[model samples]
Structure formats: C-alpha cells, structure tokens
Target: MKRSIKRLVAFVFLFLALNNTTAQSIPDSLAQKIDKLFSQWNNPNTPGCAIGVVRNDSLIYAKGYGMANLEYGIPITPETIFHMASVSKQFTAYSIVLLARQGKLRLDDDIHQYLPWFPDLKEKITIRHLLNHTSGIRDQWQLLAIAGTRLDDVITQDHIVKILSKQQALNFKPGEKYSYSNSGFTMLAEIVKAVTGQSLRRFTDSAIFKPLGMKQTHFHDDYTEIEKNRAYSYQRKNLFTFSNSVLSYSNAGATSLFTNINDLSKWVMNFYTPVAGTAADIDQLVQKGKLNNGVELNYALGISSDTYKGYKQYSHSGGDAGFRTYLTVLPELKMGFMVFSNLAEVNTYEKTYQLVDLFIKDTSAKVNADIRMDSSRAIIKDEGRAKNFTGDFISEDGAQFSFVLRNRKLYWERYGNSDLLYPGLKDSFTVARSPEIKFVFSTTPGKSVLVNQYWPDNKRLLVKYATDSIQTDNQLQMYAGLYYCPELDCKYTIVAKDHELILTSNKYNDSKLKLVGKDHLFTDYWWMRHLKTISGNNKKIIGFEVNDGRIMHLRFNKIQ
Candidate 1:
C-alpha cells in the first residue's frame, strides 16, 4: 500500500508539471498574430524566410514562409537550408575560440606568427584584431572592386589571399579604430589553417557543427557541392516580379554558411544554456573588444554587443547577394530570435525587432536617450531659409554627401538613402538616424563656411562642392586624361564624351564620371567614388586619387 501511494504521488507531480507547461504556452491569439506577421510571404510565388523563436531550450515557434524553390514549387520549411552570408562569422569565431581553449593558438599572439604571407603593415596585428575587425585591413570586396573584379564572379579563398598579399597599405593603425572589414575574418580562416593541418571547413565540421548536432550547418567551402533542399536567393525587380541574385562564393570564414532555422535555434539556445560549449567560453565570445587606447568597442569577436529597446542584446546581421539573415539573443530573458530570408528586400533586423516586441517589454533608456537627444536639438521654424543648406558637400576625408530641400524639409543624402536633418545648436544640425552626429556649420569671418561633422568618436570638416559652375563642354574636356595606378598595375583613360567624362579602365570595368567641383569628380563605382585630380608644379594634371572612405588616398599617375 505504501509503495502504491509513493507511485501515485510521483504521477500526480508529473501531471501538475505538464499542466504548468501548458498554462505557460503562448496564447493561440498571439501565435495567430505571429502567423499574420509573416502572412505576406505565405504565397506560392514569393521567396520568403524561416523564422524561429527560442525560449530557453525550446524552440516554441518555428515556421517557414513562401517558396524555397519557385521553379520546383517547393514551399519553405524549417528543414530547408539557406546560405548565411556574414552571419557565418559567428561560427568561425567559435571555432577559433575553441582552438584557443585547446591551447592550439592564442588570441593575443601576432597574426604574423601564423600567416607569414600577410605583410607587416608597421603595426603588429593580433588575432584579436582580426576577430574584432580592428586589424586596420582594407575590405576585400572594395579592394576587388577597385582592381576590376566583379563580386558575382567566382571569388575564391585563394583570390582573396592573393589580393591581400598585393596590398601595400593598411586602413589605419591596428586596434586604433573600429572598421568593419570582411578581409580580417578571411585572414582568421588562414590562421586556423596555419595552426591546424585541417581546412576551416573540416575543422569547423569536427569542432563545432558536429559537436552541437548542427547537421544542417557547415562552412560551405565547395561552391559546386550540391546539397538537398538548398534554397535560391532572389531580389525584387519591381513590385510585380523578382530576379535571381547569384552568389558564387567558394570563400569560407567571412561567409558561405549553410543552415536552417531548426539548426540555428540549437545554436542560439546554446548561447543561453551550455549545450555545446561551456558558459565561460560563451562569456569570452560575447566580450566586447577594446581599442589600443582602451576605448571599448561595440563589436565583440563576431557578434555585436548592443541594446534593443533598452535591453542588453547581442546580435548580428548578414547580407550577401539576396540572402538577409539576422540573429539576436537576449540572454537575461533566455530568449533568442532569428529571421533568415532568401530575398534581398526583406529587412530581417527590423522584422526581428517587431517580432521580439511581442515578447519583450520596451526598456525606457534607449528610447528616452534618443528622445532627449532629439528634444535638445533646436528646431528650424523657417522653411524658406532651409534652402541655403541644400547643396553638395564633400568631407576632407573625400567622403561626399548632399543636402536637399524636399517637401520643405532639409535632408542629408548619401548614395540613395536620405535622412532628415534637424537644426541643433547655433548653426548646427543632427541627422534623423544618428542624433549624436552633428553637422556644425562654422565660418571664420571672411573664409568660406564649412560644416564640421562631429561624430561621438571623430570629427570631419566638409566643404561645399558646387556642380553648377561646370556647365560648359570645354570645362569637362580639360579634366580628361590618362592615369596609371601602380598598386593594381592598371591604367584608366578619361575622355570627354557628350558633355560627360567617360572613364575606360584597362584592367577592369569603366563608368562615366560626374563632375562635383573644380578638379574633383565622382563615379557610379560604389567602392572607389571620388576622383580628385592632382596637379603638378606646372599646374598640369599629373594624376588623380581615389578615396573610397576606407582607402584614404590611392593615386593613379598620368602616364600619357
């Protein structure tokens, strides 16, 4: 009778535990609303995303929307594998940290100790610098673009290494500033190769993916290797149609991770609970980077340490070709959210934020701080006078922006994106997206007034660049010349064609130049935009320099 009573008590406790779990389960209404959030992509024709929400060890919500392959009419599911772009970095980082734990490599050790092929750029670049993106290396993509290599081409690991070998300069002193460079992560992959006899793909497979039971995840090194249920990426051609965004990357470390929502949930849950790695290792992975001067950086090893709606959050976003992926983890709440898309136009970060709002309450600090900053700005009451700010402006660093008057509001424009500019202090203004960044207009009595951009960390002065003065064909013809860059061993010839300067590069592609100001020009090339003409002692055009923000001054000499 006593043994039977004990059994009955145990059964009753189990029943109550199950009941409690059911009680805490998400409401059907809430789950339906979540379904409604992704209902737009629940069609046969559209490329969609796989969304996953993890609470502690359980993936409470896991769903896929839209077609994985439009040609075969295969709808997306949690099991479908998708190529993760820069989101691949986190895995590479974990591999490196695991290696460090094994005493195979040290994070503080100079990268030269492992990869001797990398040039010594006067400063000692540590392994930490590469992981933190503080290595002062110029971005591999930009370097390839400047050298006339198309991104859509089959760019391999060897090609990146070859290009990096040819680079004779660094972006800045190592660990001096935080500049995001995909090249650094690729170098980290090389270091792994040098330290260990295995390739990054093989190492990560044995060390991370397999151990975590992440069967769907791998560092996709072989582009030709066919996998079952692989999803194709697409971009919106218009509101009515879509086009394929081809990604031919045999590259690893920096990108080329293939995973699914189900597999990714396991990884996210591991961040909160020790499933594959120890809690101490996760602590090391999430630790923020510090500069040479000890200024803490927001970027940790691979992920970014930041806040969302006033809560401490660790997150990262990836974009390559048409693949958009975002993973955010709130360890305190034991919650993780991820949105992986096969479409370029999908704002995964914003969508994840919207989804998380259903579970996490808003913290007042981040929102209030933003409001205080905006509220402190002096507003412009007069619309007529705002027109004076509408003009092209170029920073001393060769970065260019334009101020335009649109619908009686002042906007700061760059590339194709625009942000509203609100007046701040005396002759100062703040951008809508970045309130801390102020464009303070200053005039030294008789000198031409310039806008001094005061960012939280750095300052840059920008001068007005008038495009109206060069209205004649004669003015355009004078800037036409032949220039040669020794770094890439390529020559560029400029010819005046139909009131515009047409550029023909010998080594790569070419584009027409748009005149910005005297002896200055811009181009359609995204990486290397500015073409500032250099003059000799005889007042003749000697060369031109292209500064794409990262690469400060790359000079192309006049050969003919």
Candidate 2:
C-alpha cells in the first residue's frame, strides 16, 4: 500500500511539470489581436492586403487576408504581387545612389550635362535637388493635369518629357523651398538612362534584385508584360469592382514598380543587414534633405524619416488607382513591417502601425493638453467681439483662411470645412480637437492682423482686409476675356456670370473670383490667388499676373 502511494505522488509531480512547460511555450496573444484587426479583410470575396513582419533579418510572420483574384476565387497569399505606387520611389532613389557610387555621375552635376534638350531656366538645379525634391520643378503629374491630361489617361515617360521640355520657368528657385515634385524623380530616371546604356528596370534587376535573390521584383515598365500571381486592384462602389491602372507603365523613377510582400520583406531586411549596396551608399539613400537655408526636412532620398510612439521610423506610403501600400522600418528596434493592398480604400498606414503596436514595446508617456475652455470658463462678454475676427485673412505664403460667425459661435473655415473655436482668453481662441492651433485677433484699423500660433516657434500673421466693399459687377466686366499662358500652353477664360467673375480653364474646374482690392481678386483655390488685372496703354484689358507662393508674378497675355 505504501508503494502505491509513492507512485501516485510521482505521477502528480509529472503533471505539474508538464503544465508549467505548456504555459511557458504558449503562443503570444498579440498575434490573435492582429488577426482580429484584419477581420474585415479576412474573407474570400473581398480585396485585401498582404502583410509581412521582420525582426533581426528574419521574417517572423507573413500572411494574406483576402481575395487576390476574385473572379478565379484565388485567396491572397504572401507571394501575391501588388503594384506599389510611390513606394517605388525608394528603389529609384537607391538606383541613383548606386550609380553615384560607381563614379558614373555626380549628385551636384547640372542635369543639362546629360539632358541637353532640357531648357536652361538659369537656375542651378543639381542632381541632388531632383533626388530630394528641392529642384522647384512643378510636379510632372500636376503639370500634365494643368495641360488637360487626367490621371486615368495613359501617360508615358516621353509624354511627360515633352511637357517638361516646353516649360520655361519653375515654381521656385532650386533649393529655395521644399515642394514635393514627381518631375524631379522622373528626370532622375532619365539621368540614369542617359548615364547607363540600359533602362532602370534592367539595371536594377541585374544590380539589386538579382544580387538579393528577389526573383519576383522589377520596375515593370511594360503594362502588357504578363506577371503570374498578380493581384488585381479593386474599389468598392455598390460592390467590389476591378480598377485597372490605366497609367502607361513606361515610367520607372517616380512610380511603376510591381512587387510582392515576400520580395519587399527582403528589401526591408536589407536596411538592417547590408548586401546589395555598401554601408555608405545605404546611408546616403536614407539621409535627410537640407534646404538652401540650411533647414533640414523630414524627407530623405525616397523615404520619410519620422517618429511613431517614441521609436524612430523610416517609412514610405504609396497610392495609385486602387492600390494602397505602406512600408515602415524601426531601425533602432530592428523591426520592420510592410502592408501592400490592392484595395484603394485600405488605411495601410494605420493598419501597419496597429500591427507594430502588438510586436513592439510602448514606452511613450506623452499626454494630451489638460486645458479646456467650457462655458464656465468663458471670458468674452461682447457678441460683437466675434465680428472682429470675421473676415478673409491672407498669409505670406498665399494660404487663405476665413473666419465666420454662425449660430452665436465662431468657426474657423478652410477649404469649405468649419472647425468650431473655443474661447480661451480675450482676443484669443483655440481650435476644437486641435489644441496646437491657436488664433489671436488684433483689431487695430489698417494694421489689423490675425496671428496663427501653431508650433511653439512657428507663428504666421495674416493681414485683415480693410476695404469696406468689393467692386460692383459692372466694374468686373472689364476683366472678362480670354488669356493665354505660353509657359503652360493653357488658356483661361474669364466670364461675367451672375454678377460675378467666373474663371474657366479647360485643364481645371471653373472657380469664382472674389474682388479683394481695386483690381486684385482671390479665388477659392488657395494656391492660385492674389490675381491682379493689367491694362494696355489704350486703357483696354491687356492680361493679368498671378503672384503666388510658388509661381511669383506669372503673366498671361489677353488674346480676346
């Protein structure tokens, strides 16, 4: 009987040890939370995303959450290929870095050294300026849009080059300010072709992808090239509908890259472990851009350097047609994640960050501001005080804002959206849901101004309109005519309609012009404001000139 009791005791100890081991080896619950986050896309009938997570040079998790080929009933897998729109910029930037390292080209060299056909704008735009978007060249896509080309239309590199070649001016001087321009990148790709005998696709395929063993990756320049396992892009109307990337696949630098999560994960891992490029080349690829004034911008060569919840992040997001993609890497944490989706509506950035939260430790202690202005804290007593802030305000950068009083409340309106302001102190108010934005109104006559206090050191003052009234419709008719801008090869027609002046352009939608001064007008379009009409020696209408932040004093000749 004693022997049997000892045997039972031994069995009980084994059971306890087994339970401890099972508890130690249990899978992390974070994975389940991530799976739940993608629940909407975890179906066989909808377009979804392919995600991959890498840590210390290994892919810890890779999965797909929706239909890759809806018609064929093929479920998305990690290997499913997706078009990464602007995310392709990084690879293009890397190609430039590689070429620079090979001594084939110099970053500071003038672009005219290679593309002599380019107009001499009398500006010193270097190759580095193009890579970092400081060249001041108008965006290629925007220029095309201004020239009556739509995004859905098929546009090739030659078509963009033709438009760029005819341009005689830039938005700003090189390196004077930072404006995101796709034209710079397209030019960079052309430089790559000019320096090397082959195309960007062939050069990168042999130089980068082949060396890294990424077989499914390439800068797809031909839309007709049949790619296996390619996931079709889609958008939801009443139901999911296939959206073709109608853009010509001939562009290589600014966009046009076809890759899969499996291959992209390899690219992310390269940031941690060097293989395709040398350490210096990789460093240059991610270095932040500096302006002429010595101010550094968050944008690097192709990626954006930022912070998320206390960790430093190098990331990029892309959207084109029905494809949306995001890729982020936390170099300090040695962790990276990529989400590529064929559905345009997917918030890939939010989803990727949510997934990162599960895997990374959160050490952020940042708190929201505790200051709140409620009815009990109200200090303003005069109802007329609200009127002091009501009017149009113009900033130095040509950005316009409107303050309106409605329903006994003050609202800050921009781009047709209103944000109710909370009264803080006398002559000062704070924007709701945005504690960082504060407005102070100075009611001095002729010198009245509205000061916008955004960041701690960033303050912008907008001069208040002192004029009592605008010009009458009879006076507005004098400016009505057809005006042509030779630089853009586009025309603007001003017509008097409904007691106001309506400006119509074949390239852009019609906009109503509001008379702010004797001969000056403001449009709802913020970028194109501060317009002044000119007259000939005979007192007949000659044309007008637009003085904006980017395009300063751009003139148009009156043809009718």
Candidate that would win on TM-score: 1
lDDT by residue for model 1 over 1-560, one digit each (tens)? 99998788566544532321112257889877877888788666689988888898878877778778877767677778999898899888887898899899999999999988987778899999999988888889888878888888899999999988877788778887788899999999998898898889999888777877899888888888998988898999998788899889999999999999878888888887876778888888989998887778889999998777677788999999999999999988889998889999899998898889988897654443444334324346666666666688887457788888765567789999988778865767888767788887765676565788876435677887676784578767667778877876667789888877888876556788877677677787787777778889987878887766666567789877
Worst 10 residues of 1 by lDDT: 15-24
**Cα lDDT of model 2 by residue, 1-560, tens digit:** 99997777556534432321111121468656767888788765578888888887777777777777777766677878888988989988899899999999988999999888789999988998888888877777756665667777777888888888977788677887777777887888888899997888888898889888899999888777788998887887656554444445567788888888778878887887878998798788889888887777788898897677788788999987778999999877888888888887899999998888888786667665564546443334566877777888766445678888876677788898887777777688888757578888775665565666553323466766556775677777888999987877888899998888998886678999877644566776544656767778988779877655445445688998
Global Cα lDDT for candidate 1? 0.81
What is the lDDT of every predicted structure here?
0.81, 0.77
User: Least accurate stretch of 10 residues (summed lDDT) in model 2?
Assistant: 17-26
Write down the TM-score for model 1. 0.84
TM-score per model over all chains: 0.84, 0.78
- Residue pairs with colliding backbones in model 2 are none
Provide the lDDT at 25 for model 1.
57
